[model samples]
Target: MLESEYQNRRKPPRHLVPAAPSQAEFSYTLREATTEDLPSVLALYRHYVRNSVVTFDEKPPTLRAFRAQFEHTHKLGYPFVVAQSPSGDILGYARVQLFRDKAAFRHTVESTIYLGPASTGRGLGRALLTELIDRCEAAGIREMIAVIADSGAEASLALHEKLGFTETGRMGKVGYKFGRWIGIVMMQKSLRRK
Candidate 1:
């Protein structure tokens, strides 16, 4: 192989990958993250970072940074859950983060969820979100937000509405991708206050 080609093939070091899927009935569990789970978590995020607009990040985050993100959220007492099968394959993940960095926005937080391509339509999104809201209520989060890329994410929009979120904002031509410009839809849910 050409030296340039060989150089291009070098991969960055990786973290500990989780064990392979375990065969069992259709069951899943939601729990807080651990240092050990970062690799699997990064793997899932890398999928969307590479293949979809599920998140705005143009490049995959390093596993070390991904692990630190979870650590920070955990310290803030927010919900960050990993859904796993009985044998420990991560099917998806969901987490809540501060809506903005300003002190005044602390009560408001943004919600993000990602599912493995093969795991959609099995109701895991609903389960993950239910737990997210449960944690929000417990932690006294006043408002939850979602900024969805508007090539028209129907399923996401539908799910948010079904979960009592309402459209609060929209920006036209705010996101450019796939050789075109697209809009962004922002939705929110108010919790436990008038």
Candidate 2:
């Protein structure tokens, strides 16, 4: 082949994935969630509850329960973030909640994140999770905990690991559903630099 032909045939540099919400590729914005976001949030949660082992519940939480979650988190001053498309579509959500009711556990919080099946694998999970960590740190939270179902270990575990969380405990046969018992992985991140 001629040198010019070879040069011209070389693949053009691939374009970057644009962020969501914009007409751009895969980009999105993370913002505080509101009650209006509950439907989409429940839809995503129910999708996994009904279709995957990501959660141990045999039945999805009711809309009433989800509303209570919003109220409870707000009362506790936890950060609830929604990953949104520029067009106002919610792609995913992440939040931090009090780890326990005991006084000694007040400085610690457990975090949870959920992404729509359509929104997974686009880096939205990581983005939302990192924001959860940031919000916890800013709130003087001393530790961030994650309770992961054994079957949901991949992305959730990897995301926590990337954010410096360490696996601290594992409880076998702690969750029962679908006529089966499942294990649990508990991970924690120290919010303080120390």
Taking the tens digit of each residue's C-alpha lDDT, what string does model 2 give over 1-194? 99999997785655744545654487689988899889888888888788777687778899999899789988878899999988877889999877888889988888889887778888898899988888877777888889998875688888889889899999999887666888889998888632
lDDT of 1 by residue, 13-69 (tens): 355456679855567899866778779878998988777765667878987788777
CA error at residue 172 for candidate 2, angstroms: 0.8
For each candidate, how many residue pairs have backbone atoms clashing (under 3 Å)?
A: 0, 9
- TM-score each candidate: 0.82, 0.83
* Per-model RMSD to reference: 13.0, 6.1
The whole-model lDDT of each prediction reads 0.83, 0.85
Distance from true position, residue 124, model 1, in Å? 0.6
Candidate 1 clash pair list: none
lDDT assessment of candidate 1 = 0.83
